[model samples]
Target: MPKLNYETVRYGDDPQVGASNAKQIFLLEELLRAIALQGYSFTTVTPLTHQRFLLGFDGLAKNTRDIFGWNLPFKATILPPYIFKIMTEADLLFNGGDCFRSKIRISSLGEDLFLHSHFPTNDSHAVFFGPDTYRFARFVRHSLRLFQLQSGFADRSIPIRVLDVGCGSGAGGIAVIRSLPIHQLYELNLNDLNFAALEYARVCANVAGIPVNVLHGDFFNIKNSQFDLIVSNPPYLNDPAARLYRDGGSLLGLELSLRIARHALGLLAPGGRFLLYTGMAITSDDNNPLLSELLPYLANDKFQWTYDEIDPDIFGEELKQSNYQNANRIAAVGLTVMRIT
Candidate 1:
């Protein structure tokens, strides 16, 4: 993997991109400010209406057009009251302590979405869902478009079965479900090592009316599942120590991913596709051993593989260090698609 030059990245300066990012930040700030000024008045009486108003103020409703090319399928609904209470308490705790930053923003491109900064949480190193969710969604959507084109089903219904591993907040899974035509999804499986995330995914699935089979266990331990499409936005942080949410495994950052890929090969039905979004450490060592190591495991007689976006620098050294990877060393974030024959 080579270093990513943010300056040359294509999506950086588009006006709509800038506005979308700004609006999310503004929305979070406004929410906080409103709470400070009115002591949760907005949340107390008519929380559903209040949330819609705030979403409008932040341009979220309008941005739906940019994301889906039309109105969002469902109206904005208030998070359940208990969830709201938990968020309020969490907000208070974060405000009083230095765990969370003063400002945070939401960013989304298509089905991918993320919060700007990492939040302090027990399960993962960085706070909030990282940018991986957005990146994964984009890649999967692109793959689907390619599939449609190649199969001459560009305008026809092509049902797909998808699997989401380590699905946190269920955002990545939700993104895929929302992008495709409903009822075209034959089977959707959401898996996470974290019990909390799995529970959250279940709640989200129910609320969205997207039926999913939720598995609360390690990705490496899954069995008896075959699907047409497998998608994952896995944790690839090169942390030596085990963190339930983000650290994949001990063999640098590739152990968990390797295990998942191996299992995915077994689980993919004939002519099925596996799409993954993950980061890999690219070092100065001779021959770039990582890719070769993966080739044997990721490539097989039956699958054709394509890897893109070799490397894209996302953050500075200090941030990377805290998250457990070598900040100065280059790494690659890739969209890898493998077709099983």
Candidate 2:
């Protein structure tokens, strides 16, 4: 992936081509902010459930919330003229017959509104934000609270530096940044292999006024950088299409999660923490195979490791696929490891 030139990114001063793209992103952010101010709040649901809900509405969108929030299509006449104008100028709307749909989806997280790929996100570079995003936000808040409660974090010389691995929509880390007090300043890195995802992340971080260093590549490509915190909400499903955002590879979906945990350990500074929120596949023979494999890696006494099954069963629909035929079920799991020196 070609690197986005940092020097050419001064929107107000530079006439660079990238600046034009940046300007469009700014407009998109402004549009979303305005929508949020209008009390527009939505929580994204699963694609399956979203489809079912769309059916209940007779497949015709009634208002802005129906078109944008429910990811449904709406006739242009039904749209609020001003909102439609902004969507058109912001390049956020698509024509569906006489109806128009948003190119992106907006969801609310507290006071902030997050932008992500539109409904039925089947594209290779889809930026996903949904229920798991909420869970990851909770996990990050808890981890930061734990860090503050522990010793060594009190050292003012050390600022809170975080590396968000596979930051799909940059929601996990930016949410933390927004939650932290202004006095507790921090720098963050958003890492993702998907170029589109990184672009969306940059826009999200910019909208939040968060200072983010966007790293475009696989998480393992990361090196020579130690962070006070490393967090990941990695994709853990064995998709037949091997989608960049969803496929977890051939190990019954644990491949990418394990790989991230291994490399992330080296990137954690002393007293630093790693929080991995992912799904684990439990087979017929072994109940916690993923944890068993990960335990040996964190066996050292210096590391405080804890694993919790946040949800014992999720994505039961995945079991119908051949990749998960032998697997009993996929469970939502959280792995927290802190390097204490």
Candidate 3:
């Protein structure tokens, strides 16, 4: 349970051997090309929702990569919900939304860079990549680099233990294992309340050759497990009326996230860290304080935390009004990192 420095993990001497597979590189190129054709830039979309901006495309991209070897590039976008609505609607217009299956592929150039593709149904009718996939990839890559820098894994241990909660399509786990310095002795745990999502995650993990422990139950049920590092992009919307995928809690969106955080605190070993992407409901009124409620549970002698990316405009005005129960006009999504003592 000592500080598991990823930097100290021995990733192997021949760095060029398992850098990236050729398929991944090709997929990346395809994805980039598709993005360029869209004429939409990530910069133009200032604030992006964690769910619409990342989860949708990320799940599609990872699934494509696992099943068909596609890698696609994605940029951040502000109106992700609109974009998704349009795309899904368009799909529904022509081929029926459910009939269209998204696919992605990634080919490796060397050990560091890669190419990828994102396709809707088949490669021929593929559209440009979306922001969600890009965000997903970016988060995974960033997490790996962070671990490598912090753990000093370039010269020590041969394998590392990693865990990902709410691992949709298991992309985060795959990214961690693939980018690590060792043989990726990953103890991948993918948990979700959705049976379909859990099943899909299992298939994706198996295809990627990454051994995983899939849990198709509530995150609150997990306990006593430990890992070197833990990461998640939990359901963070305060929409109690929405579907389970979008809303996983009571009136406050933090119920499930807080539960996961508390469980993660217990699961994380000493010196380990938990990285998560979520949102906090901040309103103009004094009806309720989202962060304040969770602070007590999160505040303990055993851990320290950092909250990244608190965007007031993360949601549209309409969504804000509806989600907050007509409380306020502002809320923020946070990328939080926590360290366990």
Using lDDT as the measure, the top candidate is 2
| Model 3 stretches astray by more than 4 angstroms | 1-137, 151-158, 182-184, 240-242, 285-290, 297-301, 317-332, 335-340
- TM-score of every prediction relative to native: 0.62, 0.90, 0.56
Q: Whose lDDT is higher: candidate 1's or candidate 3's? A: 1
Candidate 1 lDDT trough over 10 residues, lowest sum: 1-10
Cα lDDT for residue 257, model 3? 68
- Residue 261, candidate 2: C-alpha displacement in angstroms: 0.5
Q: Is candidate 2 or candidate 3 better by TM-score?
A: 2
lDDT of each: 0.52, 0.79, 0.48
190-271 per-residue lDDT for model 2 (tens digits): 8888866776777777777777777766677667777878899999998888888988987887889999998888888888
In candidate 1, which residue pairs clash?
Answer: 112-134, 118-127, 119-127
Task: Evaluate residue 86 in candidate 2 and report its C-alpha lDDT on the 0 to 100 scale.
Answer: 76
Residues 235-300 of candidate 3: C-alpha lDDT, one tens digit per residue: 566554555554547545667666776677677767676766555565554543545556776677
By how many angstroms RMSD does model 3 differ from the true structure? 12.2
Flag the better candidate by lDDT, 2 or 3.
Answer: 2
Q: Distance (Å) between predicted and true CA of 49, model 3? A: 13
